[model samples]
Target: MNFKPIPNKFEYLNWQEIECVAKNKRSTVIWPFGAVEQHGPHLPLATDSIFVDEIISEVFKLFSADIPLKKLPTQYIGFSPEHKGFAGTISLSSNLITSMIKEVGSQLSEMGFKRLILINGHGGQISLLNTAARELRSVAPGMAVFPCFLWSGVNGLSELLTKTEIEDGLHASLAETSLMLALKPELVGDDRPNEGNKVEIPKGWSLEGNAPTAWLTDDFSKSGVIGDSRGANESLGKNLKELLINHWSELIMNLMQSDWPNNS
Candidate 1:
């Protein structure tokens, strides 16, 4: 907001200050997109939002000294039609989410912010987000709209998150639980027996990665957990948080003023 990029909270700044910064095209805006959906029995429904919020906070803290980046308020509800059967899961239509993202991006771009990044935590809406990003390409013309998952953007995430978990896991899995353990210990309740321990994931039932197909959470899991959370620990969570922060801080700082990569 101050444009000084030091000891300043962007969210606290007034519209005049924000406009001044935006006019300069000197800062990047990061919007965290997540969902208010069920995260099994142990984790809060706001798991995705909370995780992204913490990651964005740390990324900013890690980058504040070196870069001009503004953190926008998070979008707490997202596309989660797959989790419909689960109680308390508020799923916005894919169309709604994409349209909203496009609107936000266009508004920010018109304000003269040359770069807009969507740091998404929820996986269900990723495809739609890509569409939103592409839509902004036309609407915003010269602005760079990037939609990405924090873990996927990390350098060595495959080493940290196994292919099995990344592929088969959907909710309340090892990765999400471990992250919650690190960031919000109190919110992570006891790992009830069989939670995330369903031996058979079944055919046509998966959330992310190279899967044969996708299915609803209630189609297979009774506990709403797709993998074992027993193995999660605070240490792993801490390590992951540090790794993510370091990786994003470095990558984002270097790319602040550079052109977007050739890859989509």
Candidate 2:
């Protein structure tokens, strides 16, 4: 049986039906943005991409079921591999990732997709994605491309999370570990240890400091974890997932209706 939902037409539909749906529906496309990154010893390397895909799949189902909304014009998954370092991490350069997103956005705009939602999974790609969104907006004035981080946009879920000593959630932390367990329990490891070290970049070092700056996971933490993952559990993961989906759904609806300023 063909499991592919959006791309495969025969099992779910045909090209003609897809075209008709696109023409009749409000033209919006959902892009699942993901990264090939290391997730420690226990988890699979494609953890980030896999999780993002799963989230997008669920969101598609929700839209189809509850909203019964017209099918979106287009939906696709894109990947960048710029984080390749810790054994399984694969990454594209920041420039390449930005350009790819811009091109995709441009193509979508040309296809009359006025609204594009980028469902991003990796924390490291946020800056590049932000830049890409801005460029896309400039290139396509009437098009609106909104980029959202799945882990960050969830409602008050962050406040509910147990705090760790680290400033920001690191490579793999309670939140991510919990998410993995919730999404892909088989991939989570039982023997891996958690890292609770504080983020200590060199003095005056900032994520926005300057170009040519470079650092490795070893420079930050010993176990490649930036926060505590010890307390993460399946229940928390489920709660977080629900919170994210609900919050994101609301946000997407708002964005679809909001007006884009001419000068912005």
Best model number under TM-score = 1
The most accurate candidate by lDDT is 1
**Candidate lDDT values, in order:** 0.77, 0.63
C-alpha lDDT of candidate 2 relative to the true structure: 0.63
Tell me the lDDT of model 2 at 145. 77
How much is 21 displaced in model 2, in angstroms? Answer: 4.3
Clashing pairs in 1: 196-227
Report the poorest 10 consecutive residues by lDDT, candidate 2.
Answer: 66-75
lDDT of 1 at 227: 77
* lDDT, model 1, position 57: 84
Off by over 4 Å in 2: 1-25, 65-83, 199-215, 256-264
